[model samples]
Target: MKKIIKTTLVLLITITTISCGNKSEKKEADSKKIEQTEEQQHSSSENSIQLNNGNPWMANIETTQGIANMKKLMDNFSKKENSEAYTQLKSSLEKEFGTIITACTMEGESHNQLHNYLVPMKDYFEGLASKDILKCKKTYNELNKHLAEYSTYFK
Candidate 1:
């Protein structure tokens, strides 16, 4: 009787442990599913910003054009090395570009998104205009990373 009782008790504990582990696993899987669902929803909303007439190539071209223009502006600022003027220029450019992105992302695909995306590129140039080259480089790299990430989502 003693032997039977001990075996039964051990079996009961084993079963209980197994059940608890299964519950925790289930909970983790459910949580992951919820997170994935939310990400999908957000992506869908962002993708709703259709390329003008569904032309991805044209959209890419437009985006490149704006980037090129901002690069040119940045080059000009670097040549001047005027910190105060560059700061003002950078601020205004950021504002204007932000407006364009907001308008494009809001609804109705517009040239505005391309414009806003250029703001950071302009910042990169303006940063070079400052005395602190390292700081400017860091900021420029960070901005580029953000733009790369944002572009991936749009694509």
Candidate 2:
């Protein structure tokens, strides 16, 4: 079942990415659709990321590097906490997400587990897109916690 979900996710992302191309006009709409799909998948599956039989999952170098870069981006945005910095963080994160996906070398259960971990971050990123500073700050706090927790599952 997990494999089926992962396969579906990969196909959806590939189709979305190809169809959207470089059109910024449709990027936001496409992102919302992807987010909704991820949200549904996350809710239907395990509530949180699982351990690999009581140990952290061994992540690929690109995945680890991308996550580390995203953490840095979030940290930098935290220091500013302005609309500009928030926008920059969101943009940087989107780029890192692409990097992670493109450079992914993991396969089988490990890869599926990685997707399970990534899906929820999309929600927080969506929240960061809002215009409300207070709400963004709140979401930022949650996102920061989520990023910090990444090391516990993936190395």
Candidate 3:
């Protein structure tokens, strides 16, 4: 009787585990699908930065100031060679980003254009917090390039 009871319990546990695993697998697959869709959307041409009649787009004062502040933060951070300083720089940059978003007064196509340029910046900022110092350095260089590109696309 004890052997039968033990067998039954083991089978029940296995069945429950299998059922939960299937459900989680399905959920994970669904999540991947959504992420792919979003990635496609972001990568689309409409989200890309383009010039207005071959001239740089006019950026709002707040947005321009925020970018400048972030650039300054990056400059200071580059002088320091440590992960902790990079993390702090990331925090400061995020705060400046928040200020830009809060003070945004842009409208219509200009606003859309600004968003196209700004959306990918968050990913670069996220990379700054990486555990790998080499990754952080690469991200920093990419972020610097990204910031410099702002002038090319937006004045």
Best by lDDT: 3
Candidate 3 per-residue lDDT over residues 1-155, each given as its tens digit: 99999999999999999999999999999999999998899779778888888998888999999999988887776544687777777889899989989999988888888998889889988888887788888888998899889898888
Please give the ranking of all candidate structures by lDDT, highest first, separated by commas: 3, 2, 1
lDDT tens digits, residue span 1-155, model 1: 99999999999999999999999999999999999999999966664433545443134543444444444444554423344654655665565455444544333344444444444466565664466646655655565565454443343
Candidate 1, run of 10 with poorest lDDT: 56-65
Cα error, residue 78 of model 3, in Å, equals 3.6
Best-to-worst order by TM-score is 3, 2, 1
Q: Output the lDDT of residue 83, model 1.
A: 46
Question: In every candidate, how many clashes are there?
Answer: 1, 0, 0
Cα-based RMSD of the predictions, in order? 7.7, 19.6, 8.3
Comparing 2 with 3 on TM-score, the higher-scoring candidate is 3
Candidate 3 lDDT score at position 155: 83
* Cα misplacement distance, residue 136 of candidate 3 (Å): 0.4
Each prediction's TM-score versus the true structure: 0.39, 0.68, 0.71
- For model 2, residues 1-155, the per-residue Cα lDDT tens digits are 99999999999999999777767658877999999999999877765678899888999998999999999887766444576667667778989998999999999778888998888889888777777788778888898898898898988
lDDT by candidate, in order shown: 0.55, 0.84, 0.87
After superposing candidate 3, which stretches have Cα over 4 Å from the reference? Answer: 1-43
